[model samples]
Target: MLNLSSHHLQTIQAHAESTYPEECCGLLLGHLSSDTKMLIEVLPTENSWDGEMVDVLQVVDDSSEGKFSKRNRFSIAPQVMLKAQKNARDRNLNIIGIYHSHTDHPAIPSEFDRAIAWMEYSYIIVSVRQGSACDLKSWTLDDNHQFQPEEILTVSL
Candidate 1:
């Protein structure tokens, strides 16, 4: 399960609403134990998938849709993730999860999400409808490499 403070939850929701029609991505820095993950911070990052550039991901996007669509894809630069990891380490924390928005869709993991997810990190999906956050859910990968629903416990700051 993932436990996040109410303030962080609001931050995530606001990020999702602000990026409506395009997916927003971020990192969750926290401490992880055998039974629970405590989220301490939310670090929003740019969606590198739709950035102006000719790259391997852009080639894949072109073959799939003829144009890049932030609604369907979200990417974070390696440097951004590395920086976040370093920051977490400096704070004696770990990157325990990630959060993203699903514009006009349910708060559920897509096939692409499953393909890209690591084994132990929580994946939070927030659904944005009409520029508002509608639903939120968390998921984690099981031993079979399939997504399983995870509980979210909101704590008062």
Candidate 2:
């Protein structure tokens, strides 16, 4: 199970709302104990799919011709993730999971999500409808490389 404070959930919802029509992505920093992953902080990251860099790439790469849009895709740069990992280690925490928002879509992992997910890391997805966050769900990749639903335990500060 994944345990997070109410405030953290609110923050994630707010971020999802603010990035309406586009997907928002971030890292969840926390420590693990037995079967629970306790979330300590949320580190927001820029979605590369929404940036100008991708636009430039599409012009040069034929394979990326029709892809690279934020409405259905979100990507975090490797350097950003590395930095977050190092920072988490410095604070005695680990990047236990990643979170993203699906605008106007259900909070469930897609086929692409399943293909990209790493084993043992929680994947939290928030569903934003009409610029408001509606449903939220957590998932983890199983040994068969498929997404399995995970429980979310919200705690109060």
Candidate 3:
């Protein structure tokens, strides 16, 4: 099971709403050192498939254009991945989880999400509807690359 605060969920939703058509994605960087719990930091980042570590980039689209290119692809930018990795390393934190928003679908993990997910980490999905946020769910990849529902608990920040 994964544990996260409502505030963190809100932040992710806001990002999704802000991104609109294209899809908003990021990394949940922090540590759950003890079995009990720990605070998870929400680091908003761009989608980059260049490398393993995702780096965080500055928000450039402040305007409400809501325009998604024809590609309709979502991923963390290479630079963003690098930055996120550095940030995690400096804080001695592991890549405990990942976050992404579904523009028209529910918070459940889609088939593609399940296919591309890294089995070692938790996947957080936020669903946005008509520019409004609706639901949130987390999933874990099982042995067969299938999505297994996971529980989210509140964490102290």
Candidate 4:
């Protein structure tokens, strides 16, 4: 299970709504225990996905909007990740998970997301439709590297 504060969920939803048409990405800074991850901060990041340039993700956009491209993919810079790690360490926190938005798509893990996941972290996805943020879901990888839905428990901030 993933434990996040009400404020944290709001921040994530807002970020998703703000970045509609393009997926928003961020880091989940928190404490990780044996059975749950308690979030302490939501660190939003810029999506610098300039990879391949094939616009292959366009096919993944099932909506008739068909406005897919690099916007459909998100990449958090390695430098930002390194910095976040150091910052989290300074605060006695760990990057327990990552969060991203899927425009016009369900709040479920995509093939690309599953392929790049780490078993140690949770993945939160928010579905944003036409600029409105909708469903939200969390996923974690099992021993086989396949995504399994995780429960999200909200607590008071």
Candidate 5:
């Protein structure tokens, strides 16, 4: 289960809505208990998916011929990941999860998301319907690399 304040959820929703056609991405900094993750901060980021770099995403096939955009793809740069790690370490928080938005789609994990997923990290996805945020969901990768629905506990501040 993932525990986060309503404010955190709102921030995610707002980011999704504001980005509209383009998808938004970000990191979740928090503490992890036995089976629960408590969010401490929601760090929104720019969508830096250049669509030319399939190598980073471990795409062995040349399926993508550089025809993608922020509307359908999102990527956090390695430098951003390293910097986020350092910030979390300094604040004694772990990067418990990552979050992104799916424009005009359900808040469900896509094939691409599953392919790039890492273990022990929650993934939050928000669906933006005609520029309106809706249907937020969280997921975690299982032993078989399948995405399992994660329970979200919205707590009051």
Candidate 6:
């Protein structure tokens, strides 16, 4: 189970809502701090060289009325990914995982998600429906490209 405090969860929700109509994406960087638990410490670094170029992700736009549809979606600009990595290095925080929002799907990894997942790290998924975040889930890809649930422990501010 991904153990996130209400605060962390709310932050994710806010980010998702803020990016409604598009799949909002970011990285969760922190440390394990133990053998079996992940401690998320921050949201995507806007000023971090490694994360600066990552574009805010979004899914298909709703044709009926300029909005997000109930489709599985996610995106991350390559520049942002590189900047996020650099930001992690500068902060001495190892990127234990990443995060992205699904416009109308469950907070579960989709087939595309699995295909791109990397082991040794976690992927956080937030589900948003009509501009509201409904759920959050976490997964880790194995050698066979299968997703497995992972535990999380968001640290206090």
Top of the candidates by TM-score: 5
Q: List the residue pairs that clash in candidate 4.
A: none
Candidates 2 and 6, the one with greater TM-score: 2
lDDT for each residue of candidate 5 in 30-143, tens digit (9 for 90 to 100): 999888999999999888887455556646334764656788789988899999999999999999999999999999998888988899899999999999997899999999
Considering every candidate listed, which one attains the maximal lDDT?
A: 5
Write down the worst ten-residue block by lDDT for model 2: 56-65
What is the C-alpha lDDT profile of model 2 across 18-130, one tens digit per residue?
99899999999999776789999999899876557566545444455566578777888889999999999999999999999998999998776786788778899999999
lDDT for each residue of candidate 4 in 67-129, tens digit (9 for 90 to 100): 335457787888999999999999999999999999898998988788668887999999999
Judge candidate 1 at residue 80 and give its lDDT.
Answer: 93
With candidate 6 superimposed using the best TM-score fit, by how many Å does residue 76's alpha carbon deviate from the native? 1.9
What TM-score does prediction 4 earn? 0.89
| Rank order (by TM-score, best first) | 5, 1, 4, 2, 3, 6
Ranking by lDDT: 5, 1, 2, 4, 3, 6
Off by over 4 Å in 3: 32-39, 48-72
Error of 2 at 11 (Å): 0.8
| All candidates: TM-score | 0.90, 0.88, 0.76, 0.89, 0.93, 0.72
In angstroms, give how far residue 129 of model 6 lies from its true place.
Answer: 1.5
Where in model 4 is the C-alpha error above 4 Å? 51-68
Report the candidate with higher lDDT, 1 versus 2. Answer: 1
For model 6, residues 1-157, the per-residue Cα lDDT tens digits are 3445667777767887887756676677765554443445546423221222222222212233322222444555567778778987897777777777887778888766776567777788888898888888888876677898776666454
lDDT by residue for model 3 over 108-153, one digit each (tens)?
8755566567866788888888877788888877788888887788
lDDT per residue, candidate 1, 73-122, as tens digits?
Answer: 78888999999999899999999998999999999998778878998899
Clash pairs detected, candidate 2: none
Task: Give the C-alpha miss distance for residue 34 in model 1, angstroms.
Answer: 1.2
lDDT of each: 0.87, 0.87, 0.69, 0.86, 0.90, 0.64
Model 4 worst lDDT run, 10 consecutive residues: 59-68
Candidate 4 overall Cα lDDT vs. reference? 0.86
